[model samples]
Target: MASVGITPLSAIDWGAPWLEPWRVLGEPLAQRVTATAEPVHAVLQSAVGARLPVGFAPQSELPAGTAYEQHIWDTGRVPTRDNLHDFFNGLVWSQFPQTKRRLNQLQAQALATQGVRAARGPLRDALTVFDENGALLSAPAPLWHALRARDWQRLFVTLRPLWAQAHLILFGHALLEKLVYPRKPMVAHVLQAQNAINKIATWEGWLCAAMEADAWADKPFAPLPVLGVPGWWPANADPGFYADAQVFRPLRATQADARR
Candidate 1:
C-alpha cells in the first residue's frame, strides 16, 4: 500500500467543528505552508502571547540523545516539526498551556524514574494514549453513561436531544490532525469533564488539576467515534449510521465482566 502523504496546509478546513477550539490560533497559520520551524514558532508566539509556558523551537534544538519530554521540561521549549501533527500540537499548547505543561511534567517525571525503557510503564503508556488521541467531553450524565458503556443506540439515538446542551472539545493534537481529512472510524479517547466548563482557560485548569499520575495507570479514557457525535458529521444524521458495528462496537464480555 502507498501512503497518502501529509495533507497540504490550504486543504485544512479551519471551520471544522473539531477544529473550532483551535481556529483562532490555527486558521491564520494554516493559510500557508511555513515549511521551517522559525516561522511556525513566530506565528505561534504571536498567537499564544506571553503566557505560553514554553517556546516552540526547531526540532534540531533537541540534543541527539535527550528524550523529547525531558528536553521540554528542562528548557521550556517544544521541539517542533514542519507538519500538521506538530502544528496542531502547537495549537493545543496555546489553548491548554496548563494541561500541556502538566502532561509534560508527568512525562518528564516518568522518564526520570523509569528511564527510556522499551516498555514505558502503565503510567507513561496511558499518558501517551491521552496525549496523542484524547478528547474532553462536557455532555449530560446519560450521554456519559451510555458512552462509557459503549451503548451506541442509547448514546446517539435514545438520548439524542440531550446533545443540544453538550460540548465536546478535541484536545489531542493527533486527533485534530486526523480530522483534517475526516473519516468515519476515527475515534477519540475521551475523558468526561466533571463540570460544565465553557471557557478554554477554565477547562485547561480543570484538566490539569484532574490529571493524576496514579489514576492514569488505569487508563480512564473512553473510545468515541468522534464523527458520530450528533451535528458533527452530516452522514450521522441518518438513524442507520450507528448500525455500523465495526465503528460502533458493542462492549465485549470481558470488558463487561471487568465493569462488574
Candidate 2:
C-alpha cells in the first residue's frame, strides 16, 4: 500500500537527502515492521528510529531518522507500546520549537529586504495565506522565520494577496499547538470544515487539502533532497485516531445544523 504511484509533487521529485526529511514527516506507521516498503525504510534508519525490545522486533519496529524524527516515528509506529500519552507529548516538544525557530529565521530574512529589497519566493508565500481581516488560517513553514524577524516588506507584500484568498481553517487543538502558539504571529490557526476525503483538518488538513497531500502530505514539508527515502499514503488509508470518518461525519452534520 505504500508504494503505489508516482506523484507530480515536487516533494516527490526533489532528489535525495533533503527530500528524505519531508518524506519522514509525512508517513504513518502502525508497527515497526511495515508492509515491506524500501522507500519508507530508507527514511527510518537505525540512527533515527526507536527499536523494538528484542522480543518485539518481529511484531513491530520504530521509524527512525534524526533524533526528533526518531521520536515522531516511534510514537506512530509502535502503537502497542506503552505510554502513548507521554510519547505524544515528547513528540510535540521536539517539533514545535524547531518549526517556530525556522519560521522566525525566514521572517527575519524577508523583513531584512526593507523598502527597496525583494522577499524570497518562500518568504513571500508564507504571508500570502493570511486573511483580509488580518487573521491566519494556515501559513507555510517558513512563516516562523518571517514572523520572528518582522519582515515588514514581505509582510506588506503578502498582506493583500492573503487577504484576497482567505478561506482558511485549522484543527486538532492539541496537535496544532506545536505548529503555532500564543503570542505567535499566526494568521490562520484553526478552521472547521471537511476536506474532500472527510478529515478534521487543522494542520494535516491544511497539508493534504491545500498542499497536495495526495502527493506531499506523508512526506516532510522541507525542500531537501532524497528525503531519506520516500513514503506515501494510500488513497484508502486512514489518517489516524484524529480522523475517524464515522465520528467526524456526525459532528460535521451537527455543525451544519447549528449554522442553519
Highest TM-score against the true fold, candidate: 1
**lDDT (Cα atoms) of all candidates against the true structure:** 0.85, 0.28
Q: Which ten residues in a row have the lowest lDDT in candidate 1?
A: 32-41
TM-score of 1: 0.94
Write down the TM-score for model 2. 0.19
Q: Give me the runs in candidate 1 sitting further than 4 Å from their true place.
A: 1-5, 32-38
Total clashing residue pairs per candidate?
0, 44
- Candidate 1: Cα lDDT at 11: 66
For model 1, residues 20-116, the per-residue Cα lDDT tens digits are 7778767877664434323555666666747788998878899998999999999998988767788889888888888999999999999999899
